[model samples]
Target: MDNAKLQQHAIAAECFVEVPFFDLDPMHIVWHGNYVKYFEQARCELLRKIQYDYPQMKASGYYWPIVDMRLKYIKPAKFGDKLLCVATFKEFENRLKIDYVIQSASSGEKLCKGYTVQVAVTTTDFEMQLVSPPILGQQLHQFIQAQ
Candidate 1:
């Protein structure tokens, strides 16, 4: 991955999530699909940190929708496991891309890694935007520069 660019424009946030009993599968580990929910939780926190969360995105007349996502699960998380989910901003000029890491909060062991790509679209016309709107790029620029 582009670690240099990531460090240059890094925006990240972390959240704790305890694996719930309901999330476990019949085999006693968390279901694969549940990882996406955990990623969303962390992503929401990351967006809020940049002050461009879903509400703000809609209010700005653009809708940001995830167009791509990928996940690599390395370890299984069992019920009651304390997991730390981290979301990091990766790109913002053309589209929004965020990388995610979910790991054991106690051991710092990585359990999964993933990235999500979202593109901006006009809310009124539902037109896909080839490039992200200025609002997003501007906010990310100011946030990164301030950091």
Candidate 2:
């Protein structure tokens, strides 16, 4: 499969969040670690939209937990600032990977970009998957084709 084809799997979701005071560090800006929570929120929403959220994965006899994640901070967000978080699916086959972009709603300035990779595991034996299950591939294929 081509990387370009993977881009075709892009699924996006957006959310607005206020920087709570508790998320701020001594620097008076939202702490970097909090972005992971924001990413999870958007990512979960995207997955649910496709009828394949984490619970569904487990019920389908597999567990998918993020095994890898990377984030790049382009700008800082301050307390009370509302930001837009966008999550997009970038890869789905042997692994499930999602890319995220966060931007200031008022200025449209990019605040951060990141990605998370998750691998499927058999719930019974806890074996890592080298190839995606047919259920996942079929769901993704149907979703992409319907779009």
Candidate 3:
């Protein structure tokens, strides 16, 4: 809950995705469901930077499933528009919480923002981990230490 610790331990990263024609609805704006995909792309990049991505999670004997997610749209994006999605680590204890901001890559105006929380489960027995696995803190610590 401490701001200092959160800031110090945060995993901050940004990734770019272009809105393709296929992602657009008839109105020419990106479909609402596609925003989750945008968040996923950025989340994967951030997690991969910390070696905590899906494959790594499986290798570490854990499976993390998204337990919650929310998105609020501020603007609509059209085809061929480049957007920046920034993912930041917010919490990791009983669950992993990550926040995301999607913005116009050129204008820097926020298009939407959201958060996702994932809980870990054992890969062997499929038992939910009440708290994150050891590797979570280890990777986070290493990332902070490196910074």
Candidate 4:
């Protein structure tokens, strides 16, 4: 399936955030990098709901760090603006991928969309994973089945 279609497999999380002063730049707009944190927040929430959060990942003897990230800005978000952030699981196998969408809460204007890719590494030898651990695959399968 294409990326658009894979969105169906997504486990989503939504959050409301007020753009902080520190997140803004000299032009008084939220910096691009801060969006990555927003995506992380939403994605972690989704993972936790399935009992597979970061701590569980470490306990499972694997480390999954973001290896790829992409973002498209559609509009600017200003400091103090309340916005909604949505993140969805996009893929899980050799890696975990998530897609994100950000929008202005009051105007409902689309602000940005992005995706992040994280690959698992064996904690013992630091070897990269060729396929996802059963723990993740099984949880994803169960989530899909329930949906």
Candidate 5:
């Protein structure tokens, strides 16, 4: 289904994390690279909910590798700042596209926004999959139907 249709059903996972002091730069702001870990935390939650996470993909004989990703920094987070990360499934047919939003957990200030696109490939021969594994479609259908 297209993004417009998928938005109507809306499968999203939200998670929380605090900016660790170790992730901070010399300026005491969260290092830019740390946002990707935050995004993975929420993305794992979203994937687990759909039962198509990494382990499941491996079991299904495929590896979904992240081929494209981009992030936009709206505001910088500081050490000890609490973050709320939201991951929403955007596309799952040709590739898995997940959109993310990171905001302050308390005041809800948007900090960053981005998306990742992962395409599946067979584990045995490492051939890229033109279409998603059947299990993904099945799970998505069930997820949407129940919603």
Candidate 6:
């Protein structure tokens, strides 16, 4: 989705990260794989804001695992460059779908944009759930009501 469409979701979170030297590749820019880490950081912030992070998910007898992920890199993030990562809920009833954007902290230039899709799975039986569990609905409801 486009940026305007991404803004339509009320459930979202943002976090800032400074690219670490260790994440640099031989070319001296961030490795392609590191973007996923940045996305996860922002995603965790979103889940925490909704009070349904990993611990809560497990406690609710469900495990939400990423089944799909896609990323588009527009620019290279160098070491020490600060980036703003945003994560927003795209769809959450049937599965957890989140959209992400990574931009330069100072310039606001988008460095990368991506999305992740996760589906609920039963922790006890290890069965993939066709629909999200009730706890997710409850948490999402609470988030929307609070906003």
- Against the true structure, what is each candidate's TM-score? 0.94, 0.92, 0.94, 0.89, 0.95, 0.93
RMSD (Cα, Å) for all candidates, in order, is 2.4, 1.7, 1.7, 2.5, 1.2, 3.4
Indicate the residue-level lDDT of 103 in model 3: 98
In model 2, which regions exceed 4 Å deviation?
Answer: 1-4
lDDT of 2 by residue, 69-118 (tens): 99999999999999999998787777888899999989899999999999
- Candidate 2, residue 39: lDDT: 95
Tens-digit lDDT track of model 3 for 1-147: 333476676668889998999999989899999999999999999898887899999999999999899999999999999999999988887788999999999999999999999999999999998978888988887777777
Candidate 6 wrong stretches, greater than 4 Å: 1-9
TM-score: the better of candidates 3 and 4: 3
TM-score of 6: 0.93
| Candidate 2 TM-score, true structure as reference | 0.92
lDDT of 3: 0.90
Candidate 1 Cα misplacement greater than 4 A, ranges: 1-7
- Candidate 4 similarity to native, TM-score: 0.89
Candidate 1 residue lDDT tens string, 1-147: 233565676679999999999999999999999999999999999999879999999999999989999999999999999999999988877888899999999999999999999999999999999977888867776677678
Ranking by lDDT: 5, 1, 6, 3, 2, 4
**C-alpha positional error of residue 20 in candidate 6 after TM-score superposition, expressed in Å:** 0.7
The residue pairs found clashing in candidate 5 are none
Strongest candidate by TM-score? 5
- Give the count of colliding residue pairs in each prediction: 0, 0, 0, 0, 0, 0
Residue clash pairs of candidate 4:
none
Q: Cα deviation of 23 in candidate 3 (Å)?
A: 0.2
